[model samples]
Target: LEVATPAVRREAKKNRRLKIVGARGNNLKNVTAEIPLGTFTAVTGVSGGGKSTFLIETLFKAASRRIMGSREHPADHDRIEGLEFLDKVIDIDQSPIGRTPRSNPATYTGAFTPIRDWFAGLPESKARGYQPGRFSFNVKGGRCEACQGDGVIKIEMHFLPDVYVTCDVCHGKRYNRETLDVLFKGKSIADVLDMTVEEGVDFFAAVPGVRDKLETLKQVGLGYIHVGQQATTLSGGEAQRIKLAKELSRKATGKTLYILDEPTTGLHFHDVAKLLEVLHELVDQGNTVVVIEHNLEVIKTADWVLDLGPEGGDGGGELVASGTPEDIIREKRSYTGQFLRELLERRPGGKREAAE
Candidate 1:
């Protein structure tokens, strides 16, 4: 069970791996690995085991610098091959979509554009000569002047935190009285934003564009969240899911490489199941998904596993094992393999025994 040292050279396999050679970053002791292409790959190891340094700082950064023309400098590595196979690399992290309250799910997903168009086309809006711009809170035309379309007015408390009070003029509706009067089926745009994603899906069922985007949100297990919920209010996991939903709504290129760091964070068992379905759909469509995760459920489902380290910190950073879950389970040096062994054993019909 001796750890595998960094390989001097790696042979490229057609349509298989994006190979790395002589990867030396952070605590990584000249680690070399091959990441499978067009498959769900998991990079699992103990904390501080150089997983992030190798994958994110080195591999992803290098790929981004090449494909995206990013200014980021990758970590020290001899070379990386198979860049030609990938069209783009997307790092879908837990970063906030926006810092202000003005950014919401509808706006982030571009669903608001179509929704406003629909509202503008309504007989009430047409008769009133209201344009699509009139429904937007970002502009000044039809939004509440009292709170400046924020729905809440900020009261400065010199020593204490600023107090946010609901706009008395529009009662937190964000729109002016005249704008609110233009409604579709007795529900205004503000009312739609206030509804949960699940509710919005049902309300806009007939509208294909809006309903499809809302359905993507619900599919990602954000059904309970309000369409108008501020981006700042969302947790890291929630923000990541929102981004995922936005990507899902678009047509797949089938050549995109999606890198997610611990996507299972803050997700419940049922939520994880929904996430897997979405991720697998991406892989099935000819896209690649690479996730850095410790969650065994996620690890077990991966088509390929790149397990780094027999330990953490200074004692680790070597490639402990690599390949399919079945292959990794046979490696003595991989702690991840030991856990996967238990999972494989518990599967119905005792599939592990037959695989042996």
Candidate 2:
């Protein structure tokens, strides 16, 4: 698809592309597309334009099917005609939040276990005859017996949405009255959750793993988040970054493919920089990062662009153009090409930036 642009296409060697052939699903009518990996790449198209269908449901799903290969699966599930190549595709999509104010980052990141163990295994803990499970809300031995460790009391509203009132016993802190009595350097679990990542960094400075994990969250533009904050309270972008941080912490490496859908959807213009850094870091670690994006900033940063449409809906699906920002602008048939060209033409000296 990028045959027209020699300069942009030359970087082809750097990519580990998800090659497709006759991948029939959704609006993609007998479509064949090539998505380059590693370098920041953007797949742009109008809404309902088959962008999600191709990238998320079809290509990424097929790749994952290969990973979860089991005996009970459907025959055609993993097989994609012409889609012969790729290591693994991670669909970094935002999912139903772990609601229930009881759920917090410490629990979600699996950091709470070791932390509780640290305290439980302490000499003081042995003197007090306390076990690590006692610190956990999920366990029987140590949770608040009243609300069962949930920070709130569920008020089943008959004619309205169910409301939650802060647990009168624990007062919005999931810990039981006794658990709350325990302190880690003077901060309670509720206090920790209340403290944003910015605050937690300093608060947990003495701690090892939790502090580092919180630092990663901060680096991913989640400085405003608190370790104890409920997952239900997080914004989409915040949750996405948190999820990204969880993956990044693994020091992920080798031919892995990351397929994210509009990762910058709710982010501010400046916030894109954090995501770009995350993507580039993945590439540096020898992995592939592919994003279905409408944001031009991401599109421009891409080493390759697999722009999907001439138009959206019924008129879409064809691979109108694919290449760098420069090559696309010169392609007459590509709507994105014309759209971008118009923006440049309207700007001073054709110097319009993606953030604009």
Top model number, lDDT: 1
Considering summed lDDT, which 10 consecutive residues are worst modelled in model 1? Answer: 1-10
Error of 1 at 292 (Å): 0.5
lDDT for model 2 comes to 0.68
**lDDT tens per residue, model 2, 150-263:** 777788989998887777776777676566566777766557667887887887687877778777778787787777777777777777777787777776655677888999
Clashes of each: 0, 3
The deviation in Å at residue 255 for candidate 1 is 0.9
- Which regions of candidate 1 deviate over 4 angstroms? 1-14, 155-163, 349-356
lDDT of candidate 1 over 1-356, digit per residue (tens): 11111112122235567988999988888988988777788899888888999899999999999999998899999999988888889999999989777888899998899999999999998988999999999999989988888888888899997777888999989999899888888899899989999999999989998999999999988999999987767988888889999988889887788999999888778888778778867776678889999988777777788998878999888888898788899999888999889877765431111010
Per-residue lDDT value at 93 in model 1 = 95
**Candidate 2: RMSD to truth:** 5.4
Query: Which parts of model 2 are misplaced by more than 4 Å?
Result: 1-15, 70-87, 341-356
Query: What is the TM-score of each predicted model, taking all chains together?
Result: 0.92, 0.85
lDDT of each: 0.85, 0.68
